[model samples]
Target: MSIHFTVSGLTRNLFHSLGLDNQRAPRPLNPEQSLLLECYLAGQIPESAWNDYVFETPELARHVNARRSQH
Candidate 1:
């Protein structure tokens, strides 16, 4: 047996099962990360949560920092 991924880079079966696409899937954020980033980008996350949140998901900090440096 063989498996094939679609143009979006995910297996067609997995895409259908997850109901998420590259565009719809959060950019720079892995699917495993919680939706906290969605809220963070929207500025909804409280200051109190920033420390713990970034500590648990440091990649988010790195991604944002890199984008800041590029511009």
Candidate 2:
């Protein structure tokens, strides 16, 4: 999903190749991935570990990173 979103310069090129509009969202990407993708695309995360976290062990990553309820 993220791959579909953050791939290197492939977005516009492929869109053009397939005769897709630059104005429209690409069909290859899902709605969920679009958020992180936009952030990544806009260079918000300078020291990004998003790729490793998601690809390596998403469940463990989420478990460790999940917010605990404060009492």
Error of 1 at 5 (Å): 42
What are the TM-scores, per candidate, against the unseen true structure?
0.43, 0.30
The worst-scoring run of ten residues by lDDT in candidate 1 lies at: 18-27
lDDT (10s digit) by residue, model 2, range 1-71: 35445564777778757645334432443455556545654677443566664565343223223322211
Give me the candidate number with maximum lDDT: 1
Report lDDT (CA) for all predictions: 0.60, 0.47
Clashes of 2: 0
What tens digits encode model 1's per-residue C-alpha lDDT throughout 1-71?
99866676556657656643222322477654537666765688886787687778656665555545657
Error of 1 at 2 (Å): 51
Model 2, CA-based lDDT? 0.47
Clash pairs detected, candidate 1: none
Clashing pairs in 2: none
Model 1 deviation from native, Cα RMSD in Å: 10.4
Deviation from native of the Cα of residue 44 in model 1, angstroms: 0.8
